[model samples]
Target: MTNHNLYLRLVGDRFEKTASQPFLIIPGRRPLLFSELDRMTGCVAARLLELNVEPGDRVMVQVAKSPESVLVYLACLRIGAIYTPLNPAYTTAEVSYFMTDSKPQLLICQPIERESLFDLSLACKVPHIRTLGSDGDGDLMHGLESLTPEMTVVEREADDLAAILYTSGTTGRSKGAMLTHHNLASNAEVLHSYWHWQDQHDVLLHALPVFHVHGLFVALHCALLGCSTVYFLSRFDTGQVIDRLPDCTVMMGVPTFYTRLLSDARLTPELCSKMRLFISGSAPLLAETHREFEQRSGFQILERYGMTEAGMITSNPYHGDRLAGTVGYALPGVSVRIADNNGNELPRGEIGVLELKGPNVFKGYWQMPEKSAAEFRQGGWFISGDNAIMDQTGRISIVGRAKDLIISGGYNIYPKEIEAVIDTIPGVAESAVVGVPHADFGEAVAAIVVKDGSRQLGEQEIIEPLQGRLARFKQPKRVFFVDELPRNSMGKVQKAELRDTYKESFGSK
Candidate 1:
């Protein structure tokens, strides 16, 4: 039997060959070397063992991003414990639901939140609780100086649960997506090779939050596999990104990062001349933003498509044409098809639900067997609720989520189509189209827009441009301008929130 623990693969040979090399470069602090990281994780692993955290035990973490928080994650992997990370911004009530759902044996939270969550932990029957601060001082680190490091890596099967990430509960209660060691390792290996990660040569600019897959797994795994250095920012800052762009070779970000960077005049082609790749994910990247970035930076942003269940299913080729609106082809060993609700495959160039099957797909939703069963078809293909179209060349273009499709007056209105036109207008920063309740039309098409500070625009200014471009029913029945759109922790626009805010836009019949 093979020890399929993901920690072993992540640190393969690097502990001896490049143990002293810098792994994380944090501003205003000493660089964390590979050996130092190893020792720290070992110490943390020893502490976890002391607390009786055994293999298969759930360890829930909800602390701000820090090197120590990352160490906790690595330590969980080292000891074969299931690591569950929640967004630090989640309120106590929100966390209460997750605590009840995950039922973790050990809970790690921020120092300030420990007191408030203590009673909740007690109520949830969590045996142990620890604290870890953003600045790396908390109960979790106390008394570590007196403990010996535990360097032993626990053995695990490929199918063993490694992590459980809760989906952003847009519809109902959030479901935990259970990821296995094989699911995580296979995706990391594929991405490392597909992205052309260069060992000891590539420097990654990591500004994403560690709680989500984009930052926690996709970005860190590739760097770890390649033994590369990372310029780790606490969060995405335009100035810090500009200052580091000349030194970093690769950058992974959400669409908001690019839009914010484009807002700054300091971002230039020369500043980004040394950058080898700029990848975007977690949310849809607008075509206008995509082309505008290339026009200014002299490099096309490689946009990939993925969800919490699957790490990364497809990506724009590293050495080929990166189309502005397409997410390129299915990665090697992954199969993708456009299908209807009945599991019948659709022809190319037609919009339909995206279904995929691959080694990287997660096992199932944790503790939700019936819900998990419904997400997959008889042929083992996971039915992704995203509406998409594939061209003859196999390039995938995501139209929108199926739930976001507005059926108004017996017509199907895809929000992305309206948003694309609205975004092209001058003084428009971004737009989100949603379906609001209507008395007669069943649901009315509505647009919530954020305007660029350069100009003052009216509702008609936004709605008038779509007269000849889109059908009358597709045009927004109501246009509302706001300072900005609501977003989740991962920067995806909260369309459900938008729908809720405008639910009574047309008034009851």
Candidate 2:
């Protein structure tokens, strides 16, 4: 039987040849080589085994991004333990909910948070707890030199669970998405080829957080598969990214990153001359941002579409025309179609729910069998809950989330349509359109906008222009201006929060 462990597929055969090569280049710290990373993971795996962490046991980790934190992830994979990572920004109440749900045998948190989390862990019935700090000092790495390394990779079937990542839970309690060895491995391999990863030559500017799929699986996995050097950043900083752009070949980031870069005076085409690709995901990339980035940097941003349930469904081609508003063709071996609520496929150029079926799709939502079953159709297609349209050329353009659809006077209004127009207006930076409760219309369209600070503007200025451009029902009845919009960790606007904030906008109408 074959050992289908994800660790082996990622680092087994190429270890010796790439041992001395630089793996991670961190600012103000020594570069960590592939051999050092391997040794560290081995030691961490040995430590996990010492704690009696057997195969399939859940290992929950919530530590700040660092080389040592990554070692914990690789260590879990090495021993065939199901790795569960949480955002470091999650509150104690949120952590408690995850702990009670996952019921992990072992929990690793930051040293500063250990005292509080220790009590929480005991209350949640988690057996063991350890700490790993951002600077590589904590209980998890104590006395590593004396311990023997665990060099043997545990055997796992392709269908065995490898990780469980939770959703953002904007609408309700977050559901854990169970990912198997094959689910992650197949996606990584396909992306390695699809993105044209160049072995030993590509230097990746990795600024995205490691807790999410964009940074952890898509970015890191591709770099590991190609033995590429990564410029590991603690967080996304505009100055750091601009300084490192000349030395890097590829950068994967959210749309916010590009917008921030464009705002800076230091950004120039010469600074990004060495960059080969700039890929954006985790949130929608506005057509205006895409066009501005290309105009300033002399490179088009490759926008892709994906979700927590699936690693990656579609991507703009690496060697072809990357249309500004479209997330180009579905990946090889992945099937995508626009479908109605009943799951019947829609014809080309029509908007409907996007459904996908592929190896990269997750097994199911953890411990929520009914919810998982409800998300899939009879033919094993996963309902993506996203409204999208397919072009004649097979490219997919996401309109908005189904939950973001606004119904006013019995007319369906897509938020993206309003946002796109608002973003194009002079002195308007960005906008988020949402539906608020209204006694008359059931729901009334509302707009929350951010101005570019170039000129003074009023609600009338924003509303007057939309009168001719949009239908009366589709236009926002109320326009509210703010310095910025609320966003999640991945840079996605929190529309649910907006809806809640402005629920009484109509004054009990």
lDDT of 1: 0.87
Relative to the true structure, candidate 2 has a C-alpha RMSD (angstroms) of 11.1
The estimated TM-scores of all candidates read 0.81, 0.81
**Local distance difference test scores for all models:** 0.87, 0.87
Off by over 4 Å in 1: 404-509
Return the lDDT, model 1, position 152: 90
> What residue pairs clash in candidate 1, if any at all?
none
**Ten residues in a row with the worst lDDT in model 1?**
404-413
Query: How well is each residue in 372-490 modelled by candidate 1, as lDDT tens digits?
Result: 99999988999888999999999999886776656554333568767877999999999999987664455679999999988879998998877655547667889999999999999
**Candidate 2 lDDT tens digits, 213-312:** 8889999999999899999999888899999999999999877688788888888889988889999887667677789889999999999988878999
